[model samples]
Target: MSLNFNKAEFTRSAAARSGFLRDGRPQFAFAGRSNVGKSSVINRLLGRKNLAYVGASPGKTTQINYFLVDQQAYLVDLPGYGYAKVSKAEKDRWGRLMESYFQDEGGLITTGVLIVDIRHKPTADDVTMHNWFRESGCPEIVVANKLDKLKRSQVEPALELIRQTLELREEDRLVPFSAEKGAGKEELIRLLCEACGQ
Candidate 1:
């Protein structure tokens, strides 16, 4: 189950279901709010500064990105959710794209990696995304990003809030991660490796 995280490379982006790759490789799908530093966490994970586009503006990533890692697994980056400035039509398109991907029974998704801002409770859209992952019936991991923004005393309560808000099961893996400093990266990498084995 060993993986060379450093060997990661962006493969393609899918703007629709027809564009999704279904080559049977394990897909570790990462989903998060538009402004929750999703791209930053992904960049940190791959140890690449800008491999996964860190948009100058929130909601800029409107497509699903697939990155091949060590030529084995796919790091699937789902579109960011809950951007306030987008039009209703744009939001609906995002919703439909997400729904279609999740609803498909091809099992393209192997693991669901949901990232959230550690400083706040999960939003309604986050909960919806979490539930979609659960419904997909695959193993799920929640990464609490932006951990560096919080004080030491505020960490536990913030994590607890995320736990309760997402209603994470006991078996779920919740990682408190600081993308800026690489804290918790190993644990997350371990989980992704385990996902590859599964």
Candidate 2:
């Protein structure tokens, strides 16, 4: 499968303060903790650097940003789950925002791409979100990002652990991707297209 993507446009906040209600199109989201290269991965997916705005620090992205890609689907960059720098109130606000996005705005979510650092295993928040996706009936792809940071043989064991933690089925694909080196980019794009029914 080939995906020809145009430029990506960013939104400061979701429509209705609800993470984009109105359902622009079938959408896929890149979700992970802050500083996990979620923005960089999205940028690489569309073959652009500044498309998703990688922050120099965690909690820099305080809002749910939506990027329209190729006029067919929206690539959502959700606020990172765990950021230590932010205050409790700010974190609570983001929690509310994410709750709205996940519960109320699921109609637009065709597939959710959960990213985790290859050097580290999945966190409690990551496992919780993965389980929520499974229970919510949303198609999901668990991405092991930053594979270049690890030895090749180390990838599968980490992948297996995440699959086990998430209770992923045998058919589910755990892709080891690296936005820095462009590894696994094509496979991710293919999965995105399949999720979008392209």
- In the range 38-84, model 1's lDDT, one tens digit per residue, is 89998998999999888888887888899999999999888898874
Show pairs that collide, candidate 2.
none
* Model 2 Cα lDDT, one tens digit per residue, 116-185: 8877868888888787667657889988889889887887788787777777898787899999999999
Our tally of clashes for model 2 stands at 0
Q: What TM-score, computed on C-alpha atoms, does each candidate reach? A: 0.97, 0.91
Worst 10 residues of 1 by lDDT: 82-91
